[model samples]
Target: MGCFAFKSKAKNQRAAASGARSPAPTSDGQKSKASSASTPTRSIQELSDERGAQRLRVFDLDELSSATNGFSRALKIGEGGFGSVYRAFFRSAGGGGGGRVVLAVKRLNQRSLQGHKQWLAEVQFLGVLEHPNLVRLVGYCAVDSETSKHRLLVYEFMPNKSLDDHLFNRAHPPLSWRLRLQIMIGAARGLDYLHEGLQEVQVIYRDFKAANVLLDADFKPKLSDFGLAREGPTEGKTHVSTAVVGTHGYAAPDYIETGHLTTKSDVWSFGVVLYEILTGRRSLERSRPAEEQKLLGWVRRHPPESQSFRSIMDPRLGGRYPAAAARQVARLADRCLVKNPKERPAMREVVEELERVLQMEPPTTTAADKDGDRRLPPAKR
Candidate 1:
């Protein structure tokens, strides 16, 4: 499940400050020799076959259970339509010093059809795929001889919570402008990697949204939840046939209407995320009165051309960000929301343009000092 699917303020709060790496408890947890080679370079097909054959080593449920204190309520991180995520600490088989890596364990809901597919897909995809901006696949476990129920997928824990928590939740202070810009760039880079970064062929990430983007302690964005990913036609087939499985507001209109899944579909979702970053709002909203339910539609009606940007600025930001930066973001968002996917900018172009705009951004202000006149180099040294 994507981050939006889960709604836990406490877990989100802890995650907001720290990457998902959990510290090992003081007692009761068993220690095992970390795998000598946790991940060896391998092709996707090879990994997929390996998973089927049980070549992927399984972690003892008892160890994870003990680590999480029997999935104590306090440790329950995030839960979505598919399952609840619990933070756990486990020793690496490779014997690395960072024995306590925060891991997000999704325990699948047995009755959920969508969750079942998502669980397997995540295990398969992350099991093989490796990248920095993308969450790492530590390992996974399925039903077995003794404990043959409850499907679970574990991932490298990220301290900072999902982008949604920072952008929407009020508990945390507003993220600095620099952090926000970096997150956007990191996310775009992650998407760029997914779309074209693979060695053999491209992969299309069908789902892209703020909630799907996790942040580290430094606020670097890491894209997760690839259940809807489809291999590019060059790798397997140019197209795939499956019912749409994305959040409503973020889904590409053409793909939703005609079921044509392509790299452009991901671009459209990216546009929605870009819009969210600029405006600091959910992609879709019904909280407003009935007439204002559709966010994108409302944005189109009150395009940046005709109105003050303040109408869409997040109240929390206090209009503190640069006006030029905001306008540049809004303009790029407009281009991304083009109904014709062909008209939208390519991911590479988006990355390049955002990098340029980020350059124009002023340095971030720190908390320790008053608004002083350091810019004028003193009257006399």
Candidate 2:
């Protein structure tokens, strides 16, 4: 509930270092906007060398205070162990006459010295990274003055919030089958970039769950939350060894047991989400019957190859989705969930598989039922 709370590492050990790169003021002494690039590392010395932090804009207390009305509870958009996220607005950069800019400001608790590392990690990584599928880090604020010390991160406003919201909240309209697949493909591309995009280093997203996948106004999925992200194994190294910390039921078993993390570990988590989009169930849902409590365990009973598989699809779908495409999604999810990490398909392969499903012929729409639910014929295999 506290947003990917980490348990293994001592809170003190992760405190912010005095020497890590902190936000710098602009030349004109104005600090409203940044380069608009989205880009992480945790070690203070190591992250400082990356120099990605320099690219970000710095926000003064006044700007943050004005935007959130002195961090009012009314403007609070999200809350967790680390801090609260508030929706804020500011005058756009360049000219005083510029339009208003919508943003989300994450104001970390001052007492959470333990979480300053995570805040810095996000600043380091988001500063250098840029991608359509990765949430953009607009700016940051870090102050250690006498009165108060502030650490805040500014991000482009995600009007649609997160995939977790749309998937689990019954209040929201059910996502169409086509839109679901599209969101998955886009998220896969974001993960693929982290795994294979950087020339010198790869990012292993330690936490890959529905909640971390934020959506823009268009429902475009973008990966967020770099608090637990770690650099992938260097050349010749099999995997990075670190304390396992991720949301329960979403972590890869091998990583949980061995503290060894690889891109494949992310692949496994991605598989869990693959099933999530298909079934509209969290990785671990306890509200169902005893046999259906755990998503993976319950899904195994009805393999994609079996006739019972359709039973696991989100009932909210009302049989409107293409039957064959749905089955293929289940099959792909299984591939991502392979017990052997080495055997899991790469994110690129996962994206390709999903794309192929989208290319398949549309399911023929037949007559609507008495309730007006249109029955869709199974897609061609």
Q: Against the hidden reference, what TM-scores do the models get?
A: 0.78, 0.83
Strongest candidate by TM-score: 2
Please provide, for model 1 over 49-164, each residue's C-alpha lDDT reduced to its tens digit, 9 standing for 90 to 100.
Answer: 44422434455556567767887889987877877788987666668576665677767776776765566567656665667688877665544333235566777787878998
In model 2, residue pairs whose N, Cα or C atoms come closer than 3 Å (at least 3 residues apart or on different chains), thus clashing, are 38-129, 39-125, 39-126, 39-129, 40-125
Model 2, 218-270: lDDT tens digits are 77789998867776664456777778888998899999999988899999999
Local distance difference test scores for all models: 0.65, 0.74
lDDT of 1 at 133: 80
Q: How does model 1 score by TM-score?
A: 0.78
**Whole-model lDDT for model 2 versus the true structure?**
0.74
